[model samples]
Target chain A: MSTNAAKNLFIYGSLLCFVVLVILTIDTMGKLDKRAPEITEEVNAGKKVWHKYDCIGCHTIFGNGSYFAPDMTKATERKPKEYLKKFLLDPRVIKADSAMPKLGLNEQEADDLIAFLDWTSKVDTNDWPPKPILASAIAGKAASAGQALFQKHDCSACHQIQGIGGAAGPDLTQVGARRPDIDWHIRHLKDPSSVVRDSAMPAFTDMNDEELKALAEFLITLK
Target chain B: MKYQSHQIALNFYTTSVLLFLVQVLVGIIAALQFIWPDFFILNFNTIRTLHINSLVVWLLMGMMGATYYVVTEESETELWSVPLGHLQFWATVIAVGAVVVGYIVMGLNPQANTEVFGTRLLNEGREYIEAPRWADILIVISVLLFLLNSFMTVMKTRKFTAVQGVLLGGLTFLALMYLPGMFYTKSMVKDQFWWWWVVHLWVEGSWELIAAALLAFMLHKLLGTDVKVLAKWMYIEVGLVLFTGILGLGHHYYWIGTPEYWLWVGGIFSSLEPIPLLLMVWDAFRTTRETRVPVQNRIGLYLTVAHAIFNFVGAGLWGVIHTLPQVNKWTHGTQITTAHGHLAFYGAYVLLIVAMIYVTVPSIRGDKEFNQSRGFQSFWWMTISMVFIVITITGAGMVQTYMERLLGLDYVTVKATYNLWFWIFRAIFGAGFLVGVLMLAADIFSIGKRPAS
Candidate 1:
């Protein structure tokens, strides 16, 4: 190829691509506000809170940032908001060995951060971060609904099942074998201190009778 | 050195090497923290910021130095102002030092946006461009001074070679792309959109131009290739790089809250990105075989060849693996990205800088000939260990995808259990890579000390 020909190829080809990219960028920018329309004062403040601790340095949002922690794009979808706030204030409260360092954020800051994450969770990512397939495969009929509730309420944060969970609560791998009464299990789940005096486990009054029954049935099958 | 002012490159090269050592050390700390979470008090995020920041600073320093060295000889004159070059170099060094100290000592303040003029006064907390606003301004000043020195020298000669033109173009865009990253946005998606203008456009777009021109210059000098032939191919190669790379920015956009059209634009364009890199490797081999002259600096040639091959594998092949939105949806934030990142950066940019050093340092130091044993050994050690690191990390990523994304396992559970062995092996390979770097440092520092053979 002649030098001039090659130079023109470089110049024109790059110009063409550059022009197209600019047009697409403008179009995308115009559409971004509508796609992620949750930019309230609290959400903006939450974003600042995220930056203040440099959370992107650990946890990613939109699959950008350091890979030290889980992606927070759908964090609010996975964990309850109140639980997330408490966990943020003191991570060790939920999981004793959580490597997340306590950042001494105030209650307001934690709320704002959650708000930011909630807004982020709603952004259209073209179905990014596909749901895990193995969870469905391992989720038996009884375990499916109850297991989801287990994760939703963060039971594994304190309780261990089959030696795979936290140590704060008693090992539930054989809890069903010991406490075989379904009614007793339901009462304990609803009000932990009612069944056993001074129980540290939080009461799950929010869970209905059906959820509590499903969780108990799933727990008994753990053995 | 051909000109007295060419010696300024040595200072930049010196700082670049030192910062490289700092990056590697911090990288080791980060890997350790990954395996054993409580290994340090500073935590993984802070250490990681230092690791990434240093890598960028050192690589830019090396690229700047290489540009100066190349432009002086190409223009057939001394630099416009050696004193200004030195001033720019030290100013950059101080800015880098202050930024490092700020991250280590003060940490990031959550209220930085409010405290400063709509920018972070200390650490910006953004990935890669994490330097505070002051450091960011210093970087711009340093780049401007360096550009002025270079442009004036070439202007005086008024004889522009294709190599100099392309190099200058690359450097100009490199400086321009950085400006978008400084613009802050309250919207997280918009912030990331511009952040990539600096990151993606840089490594994929402008740096490819710089790498291609520098490689062309090196090949022309080392192998006595015809300037016209190299220029023609260089133009074609970098033309394709920019053509594909500019639109390939969509790959990053696919999952960053951008419009859905990115999935198609990013997937198609990025898949084509590998074609130019393949052409680059093919052209290098073709040039080498056609040259009748025996290469005196065999290590330089070895690294140059390796740079092309590894660039094809690391940047081109590995990048395309997940560039498609279909595959990237599963592997977006997994260790798969980490695997591709390590090899791509090391292969494309790291090896290029080191190759430039190997080619020029001997001539600069007045060494008639030097031992090639350490240089060759370091090359194999780093290349082998790096490939292994990528392999182990890729394994970890696939497992992570299956457990976390596929099976719907909790992120922490998969991190704690399924990927432990891969992390261990990755750490081991990282240590091996560090040893190779130390040997490389030894070889570079030993350039003038050895007796001419």
Candidate 2:
């Protein structure tokens, strides 16, 4: 083909492609615009906190940031509010080995962050970072009681059971496989320093016997 | 050099080479940090940001230099304003240096890090376009100065070659794309959507045009091929590039809170992004085979051909592997992406710039015996090392995806499982790549002393 003809073909083809891109971009933007949640003051403040600290430098949100830490897109659904608050204020309080430094956020800042995480949890991520097997394992009345105890004791603040929770502690998804003895877990939970010397884990002496048994049973089902 | 004004390009080239060395050193630090997180006092983010920002800066410097060199020669005239060109070059150097220093300081003072600074300074945490607002402004001004100098030179001669037109067009688009990265948005989705305009468009769209123009100019000079024929091929390549690449931006949007339609749009268009590159490879080989005169600078031809071939493999082939939405679900942000990034950047931009430097340095230095055997060794070492790096990283990424994403293993387990690949990557491929870069530096700098030939 002649050079001018090729040039014309290219110019026209590119123009056509640009038209298509514009249409698709408009359509996608419109959809996203509709999906954008109302920017409440709390959510905005939370987003500010997120950026001020550059959370993206360490954690992935919707699969965009560094992979050194877990994805926080579903943080609200993954961990309870109190646990998230404590972890945010002092990551080591829950997970002794957490790489997340204490951001020294005030109580209000921590609450704002939770609101932001809550908003993020509602985002349609197309079922990404799939749910943990422990979710299904912890079912029924006994599991419910154990879950309440787990939240009250802020267990998820340290131990990640699935794709959720902090990374400082060991993932409890397979805790049952390692320590199957219920009696051993009960004793260990009451006083972690007794079983493992130099254990950074805080003991759960405040829990009653019934609550301890339920939590132990719940952990056993993690396998 | 053909024109006295061509000396301006030498300044840019020297700066580019120095920055290239810094980029490689920072890259080594980044790779080591993956194994030993606390190895350097500089955080991983800072080192990585420096590595990428330096790469972009040096490559731009190289392209600017190549543009001046090619335009002057093609027009058969001196630059429009040698002083203006020098001014732009210096301004660019200072601006880039300040940005690098800012990143280091911010890394040290993470608490004081803020995204908002009323546009006077905005040190964003975004990848690639991490330059603050002031740096962005300086860059835009520098690019404007360059475009003015180049366009003025071409217009004065009244000699608008197809090659010059394509390159100038590409450079113009490159400057325009940088605008999107300067703006701040509240939504991460919107922020990323525009970031690809700067990133993907440059690599896949405009930069390819620049590369093709340089390739054609080099071939025309070396092989004495028909400029008309080369121009025709360039037009075709530019057509394919814009047609596929503009829409190919969708590939990045699939997981960044964009609509689902990107799944199909990104897959189909991005898969076709390699056609122009493949065509360039074919054209290069055919022209060489038809050359009646023996090639004098074998290293130049080797790097040019390697640029085309490796661009196809790195950007074209590997890019398509995970470009599809289905596959991307598994490999997005994984080592697979890193593999593609390493190869694609080296293949498309790095090697092309080196090819331009290799072919042009002889003329710039007035050296006849420039193509030493060590040049060829550098070529093989860099190419082979890059191939191994891509292979190892791809393997690591695939395993991580399978174990973590598919099998529901946690990030820590998958990371531990792939420790061996990281070691291999640092010890072998990383070292080899660094050595190759240093050898190329030695080859380029040692051009004047050619045994008094």
Best candidate, TM-score: 1
Q: Could you list the CA RMSD of all candidates, in the order they appear?
A: 2.9, 4.1
DockQ of each: 0.58, 0.38
Worst 10 residues of 2 chain B by lDDT: B114-123
lDDT of each prediction vs. the true structure? 0.84, 0.78
> What digit string (tens of lDDT, one per residue) describes model 1 on residues B337-427?
9999999998899999999989888887875688888888888888999999999988989988876777565667678788888888888
CA shift of A42, model 1, Å: 1.0
Question: What DockQ number belongs to candidate 1?
Answer: 0.58
iRMSD values, candidates in order:
2.6, 3.4
Residue B8 of model 2: what lDDT?
82
Top DockQ: which candidate number? 1
Model 2 residue pairs with clashes: none
Tens-digit per-residue lDDT, A77-128, candidate 1: 6455766887788877656778787777889999999999999899988788
TM-score of 1: 0.94
**Model 1: per-residue Cα lDDT at residue A220:** 71
What would the per-residue lDDT of candidate 2 be over residues B98-188, giving only the tens digit for each residue? 8888877777776555645643233476778767777888889999999999999999888989999989999998998788788766666
Which digits, one per residue and each the tens of the lDDT, describe model 2 over residues A12-104? 888898788878877877787555566678986787777655566667777766655667777777455756777788876666645556656
